[model samples]
Target: MGEAKELSQEEIEKIKEEIERLKKEIQYHDWRYYVLADPVISDAEYDKLVLRLRELEEKYPFLRTPDSPTQRVGGKIEGGFPTFPHSIPMLSLDNAFSEEELVEFEKRLKRFLGDENLEIEYSVEPKVDGVSIELIYEGGVLKRALTRGDGYVGEDVTPNVRTIKSIPLRLLGDDIPFLLEIRGEIFMRREDFEILNRELLKAGQKPFANPRNAAAGSLKQIDPSETAKRKLDAVFYASGLIKGVEIKNQKELLQKIFSWGFKVVPDWKIVKGIQEVIEHARYIYGRRKDYPFESDGVVVKVNDFRLREILGEKAKSPRWAIAYKFPAEEVTTRVLWVEFQVGRTGTVTPVAILEPVRISGVLVSRATLHNFDEIRRKDIRIGDWVWVKRSGDVIPEIVKSIPERREGFEIEIEEPRNCPSCGSELYKPQDEVALRCPNMSCPAQIIERIKHFVSRNAFDIEGLGEAIITQLVTKGIVKDISDIFFLRKIDLLKFWGIGDKLASKIIDNISKSKEIPLDKFIFALGIRHVGESVAKILAKRFRTLDEFLTANPKEIETIYGLGPAVAQSVEKFLRDEKNIASIKRMLQAGVKVLDYHEESEQRKKGALSGKTFVFTGTLKSMTREEAKKLVIENGGKVLDTITSHVNFLVVGDLGDRGTTSKLEKAKKLGIKLITEEEFLSMIKGS
Candidate 1:
């Protein structure tokens, strides 16, 4: 070990100057190689500068400081992960799923800047599909590495992050900030991920699901050695909690960080104007397959720090930056089988069970065929290779079958003649495409009904998932949705995975679910054609289940918006003895379905009351589910399509010049076309 010897003034000054000069040279080379993707010097030349700095620091120990380039090596390993509060929150970016959405993002930025014709410069970079982490460097020395746990608070994994070669151990120059927290993504390259997975498989371990998952798992490992073995890399994207840094824009920040011996994200371009932003995003999106690592989208940020500050952020994401995601990745996989799923409404949907394939970072084993008609239309068959798409990055859908790839032995998918659950005759209604199971007491129907009851849009039971619902039904713990509330702790504990804590939580959720609003409860009943909107309408009209159950079809038909199909479905559900018995059981279980009729009155007079909204295209601020919920919660009605009754059309970014029937109808009906932002404003005002 080098001694902490007292050095002569001349010797100390010479060593310090040499160290600073070497640090600057090395940093400049790093910037050239890593950031600009251009290097003037060879690898040996760069190493020599670092070696010289090390030699000088060794000869004159007093000349060394934390800010020296040599100090970039990781600090002492800790026994346990400690919590670290982020000096600045690592907020997520708002997403733009389509070109129109990206355009809308630019429009919003200009609007926020109070200039319709403002020439806004943007920095566009790949939105890496990886784990987000923050690196804190004090006096240029690596201080801590933190996982973005909740944005505000993070788990310290300094020991593990030290293993990443791309992240610098210390700042490059003495001119660097006293304290700098860099936000970056820790990712595994595609080739590296594949190699690691293969090694894991050879070692008789389960292969990683995807590169992102692999990166996350590697970073969280308790053993630093394990993380090192995984060969994780990082790219610094933005600055957080920086002291003594006067960076003015994203471009400057990128260059500055790169000059500090830190790796900057690749393919990032500084573009002028909104059109360039969109063009760059689209170009990057199209070249996704060519990249070395996984990237789902392109992130576009305002180049100016002032613009970013002015634009500010939302509760969850930054308003200044938008992630323009590519259309969900489509890959070909074989259909192993086609199964019929009996819904709570007894509508049998055709689900294509596929050979497990990875699609857009997800393990997709099943895709929806919608119905038997769709299967026929697409000519999907067992043993046929089909193009399975992760639609919108959420749903797995069979886009089309590769009929050319189909073998002669491929079997055509046959429509089920009888219900798969109860073996009852399946019937298809004249107006509908789905085959229905008439037996209300069918096991599949019961299971599905229970699932529907606990779904997000219905009772919203926190702990009662579909798998748990199936287990409860199969184990005879629950026979109907009402049985969920009446389950004993002992009964739930009998299930394999239902531990004491989980069982207690399930009980609590069931107890909480009893106080659900009238509309949600009505929708939870598994009644055909009685979706959330119809349920809301019925709840508003009748006020209570007792009132609704007593009303005849003709009486229900008198209500505005209550069509013949919906009225018939409601009347039929109420008249059924089995359904009535189930309702009675639910009542006996102490279910207190809250009345929303009075609230409906208050809502009608409220801000958005009397307003009917129709949503078109893709919304950026929220999901379609969230949007519908917002409308309903704000005392407004949501319609599927634009019509004369639709007071406002909440239009989203419908990419390109595609014609929308809803837009046409809205214009024809003189309905106001409002943007998603405008709709959000209306909701907030209400």
Candidate 2:
């Protein structure tokens, strides 16, 4: 390769000017926040400075890139993946359950290294609940993306990986070195997760169980388009291969990754030894879920990479790393009483009210008691000091009461005789934990139903929380669900803190919600056993609200997933006089009953419609999955290698050479290019 041409003196001067400005701006803020612990600027203000540099990059388009602070959100998620062979295997880390186990790991480390002089310096970080992935960069260009499959061999998911905007397309800015293998955890944001699950419900799909599962399930989508729609991100934690870099320690590597525009974990402090590490561990445990993402535990790794290399591998995992889980933050609190809440599934859940106590950096005044079985098994009683725990930022659960500690004060446990909400007799269903509230018209049920109607999954009415809902009912600003649609902002403003701007936003959201899809409308009705998925299935099957309402229960039950019980619920819900009147009120108020059946039907059809593909080399124009979807929709197949039966081979060079063999064979056998333009065309072809 010939020497690349240098810019003119004027160009160089301008680049120098921009670089100086960026450096001063970054360091000034770093000191103010990191050192001083007093940030004058908000996150959005900091983002503005970075965004300016990015905008400059777009303008100049070819400045000598520096490994400056701003490149972390990655370029554009590249189109296709290229092959990358690991120079060093990115291995897993070992776990330490007890203090004794940690001491054993330390002792084992000394034995492995056979060096008594080793005073191990470690880097501790929160172990986020997410999927692990690898990003490969060669000579500043993003080469490939990989999953930590089996440690040695992994699934080639370049296409799917390309959707993550955080993984750079070509290395952003000055770039780090010739070869860099960045390992990271991919996770979804909490707000994004809530949004996605809401959408999932409206689309008639099962909601993801949790954030970690959501991230895992999202990254594995064969359709890049599907994955792309999900807002997912990656956080770089460790390195696999470093070329031309002399960062001697793990802490430096983390800072370097941050400087190079990788979203490394937050800063860590070094301790003299394990004792300090233990204190730091406790401090982190105290504040674990306070962070944006969920963390199962904290990972303690040997700081020095050279020292780590000396310690080497033990079995499958690196000997240098040990994870310390937060001690379960269980609390002893009093459960004033147990109450049952009926969910969309008709499963009534019992919740416990408690004397407020701070646990795990959160106020714990309530806990889920589970049910009669849990209460009996734990021997929980009123006025008892019951143990409560909140893990990974979720709802708190009661573990047990101190039976032996009971003075004559703790009263006998008694399950409520009747539905607290409806005043009907409460009965425990066969093989069930919850006590049921069969009367749907109960005041509590109506209140909960109203809240659900305005929930993010249903109408998505903003500025309407449970507190506001209660106030609305009391003030008579709203009654039936349809009342929300009929009301005006002037009506809402009568509430105590309701301001002009917020009131406008709420009323606007209400107006906007009138255009909601059919599934949301159905969910807003609060029919028993009718969640987002069932609503969508019904919406698509019936194609119209009128068609669905009039359809016989037998026809409703014909849908594969809809059984007799669900069908009966649907019919019963539609037959209710209140429900019938509510629908009329909604339609009269101009609420849209949309037809999303065509789209939902398309999704149900397997979406691969069943086509397969295999790709090689880097795809510069688009991601592997994006291109794959095109081939799949065109009724073509993609294979991993250039076998005789291979229908097509996407032959493109990223920065790898190993894929040449497959391409050469494809040329001889005339396998096709999952062409960029044609691939895009094919995706929409269906």
Best by lDDT: 1
Clashes of 1: 3
- lDDT of predicted model 1: 0.79
| Candidate 2, residue 464: lDDT | 84
Q: Give the poorly placed runs of model 2, Cα more than 4 Å off.
A: 1-33, 36-124, 127-253, 257-296, 299-327, 336-349, 418-433, 599-686
> Per-residue lDDT for 337-415 in model 1, tens only?
8888898878899888999998876678988887776777778889999888774445588888898986699998888
For candidate 2, what's the RMSD? Answer: 18.6
Against the unseen true structure, what C-alpha lDDT does each candidate score?
A: 0.79, 0.68
lDDT of 2 by residue, 1-686 (tens): 01113666776677768965874576456445533447799989988887887766656555535334443223333322334445567665655545665666677667667875668787878787788888877886666778776477555566666666555555544646888888888888777888998999998887875677898888766467777788787777888878977788877887777766557765466665676677777777777667656676788888888878776664345667877656557778777876667654345677888998866434577787666776787788887877787654456888668877777777766777777655777777664457777766555666777888988778888678887787877666676888888878888788877778768878888898887787678767877656555666577688877887787888877764455656777888877888889889998999888866455344435333444445776443344544554453344444334444455455554231243556676678776657432433344442
